[model samples]
Target: MNERPRGIESVLVVGTGLIGTSVALALREHGVTVKLTDQSPGAVRVACELGAGDEWEPGGDRVDLAVIAVPPQFVADWLLDLQKTEAARFYTDVASVKALPIEQARRLGCDLSAYVAGHPLAGRERSGPGAARADVFLGRPWAYCPGRETSPRAVAAVLSLIELCGGNAVKVDPVAHDEAVALISHAPHVAASAVAARLVGASDTALGLAGPGVRDVTRVAGGDPDLWTVILSGNARPVAEVLEAVATDLAAAAAALRAVSVDDDGAIARVTELLRRGNAGRSRIPGKHGGPARAYAVVQVLVGDRPGELARLFQVAQDAGVNIEDVRLEHAPGLPLGAAELSVQPESAEVLAEALRSHGWHVP
Candidate 1:
């Protein structure tokens, strides 16, 4: 097996929750030794049992990098204590926001020179080690904030770690990082929650009639409330600013909708234009960071739930030189067949569909 670079032999990951465990797993995949720890001893044990890192060891050993993946509120204090030990030569954090931690670190007299702040713009609704995936960060954009006191070596080490996890790193100032995340991540969470909150008391009949659009809009609302509360609190100012803008736009939309009357064709057109602008604005968001926006020619196909059906479909696609960008499986009761939503490049969709159909699979 390949080994980590000789100079950086050991990595200590503080907080073995979903993000931390996933970082350990990804680092280990590249043959790096990792030590995992969390406030709760049981949580640390769970991470080790899940093979996220090596068994915990007491005392400070010479280590190259320490990745702090705890909640934003706890990062500064943890980094303060970790910096006192020889356990780490340099430190980096995966907190969602940056400015607050930098300020807190300064207050704690932590050595910002050996610390770099990083945020990976990738996550899932699930929490803890069980939900961690080695490839969770693959192809995702990781933002790095190098404070004024940050050292060259510290920046380089964190950049290397980002690349090692199969991510692209972009440098941004701490304030900029907070503002950007407020617009893209934090505001969206609040919006999703707001939408989902509206449905809390809806009748079963109303919910049963909901479609994919509603499902997609409210998906992030199912995320861990405890985790989100910490994140939202840490970046409350920027988040509130963004939400205020959203409120203004929502008010205008409501006004336009309320203006619908027999003599209000102009108001109706205004509402339509507002909706169009929303669509256009959303389309501007990058689909996947590394690659171009995937132009998916979605193909629905019928396959059995039994083993090998998926393998056969994948094999057929591979043989046809069709790279499947994404896949979704749906099943209905009383039917032996399930529908697979295959997202392939538009150019290969027709040929791939034909190939699967020729293999005795039902293609739509």
Candidate 2:
């Protein structure tokens, strides 16, 4: 682990949610004193119990940095209040949307020089302090938006914070950051929710027939709706713009499907083109190590529904000296066994499969 940044001996982390607690934990691990606070006293207590940080109290020594890990809508208000109190020499936030909060801070007459906006592009499907992991930001992009008026010292402090968390810091303008996340993060979340909403009226048999495809598409939809509502609404314009384009594509897809139902041969080409474009778009997403994405090969293993089955499967991969890039479990309704798809680099896939077979595991 890297040493804590210079002059940042202590940090005041506001809002002891997943991101806040994770930041506190990472900072505390690096010998930086962290003080935790939240509107919900219970949340702060939970985070403190998790060793994220000590409970924050007024009249404490001034900290070098103050991180506001609140939702997008609440960031500006906190920024204004923190400034009124001279909370820290520098301040930053971990809100997903940037432009709104920046504009709000400006409107509130807060000192821009003392504040830098930041967002850590890391999270799980779960939320709250219990789901927080100290290593969540590792190898992920932590974006910082320091406006023209933002001080260099503030920017440096935030960059150091990202470094302490073992994250790669990327500098971006606030407006650009908001627009980018709308397409990549915010809008996709809305689309996922829309797709998942269709399941509300779906027959039990239809839902039971769902495979990894549906599960993967709707996975993010499982996120807290109340939280996402605030996020989507905060970036409403950008998100809506992207959703409009998605609607166009969806309409075309529906028309093509309808045409195919009528046995129109030309509809197949249209559907194939849409799918091809999707493939091309997906391919453009940067992969690990900042290189063009490499397609991984998957080896499926059948595991009986019992304790330690997953642990045994992982041990098999560890013994084979194969690094699993990703793993997904798919279980059909009423099935006693589930299939675990272990994704590895193409060369390692065959090796992994062979090794699992030799270990008396079903690799089919």
Q: In model 1, how large is the Cα lDDT of residue 244?
A: 97
For 14-46, candidate 1 gives per-residue lDDT tens digits of 999999998887778677889998888888888
TM-score of each: 0.79, 0.80
Which stretches of candidate 2 lie above 4 Å from their native place?
1-5, 288-364
lDDT by residue (tens digit), candidate 2, 114-218 = 999999998677799987767567546899999989999898899889877757689998889989999999888889999999999999999889999988899
Among these predictions, the greatest lDDT belongs to 2
Off by over 4 Å in 1: 1-7, 261-263, 288-364
Q: What is the lDDT of every predicted structure here? A: 0.82, 0.85
> What C-alpha lDDT, on a 0 to 100 scale, does residue 351 get in candidate 1?
94
Any residue pairs clashing in model 2, and if so which?
none
The ten-residue window of minimal lDDT in model 1 covers: 286-295
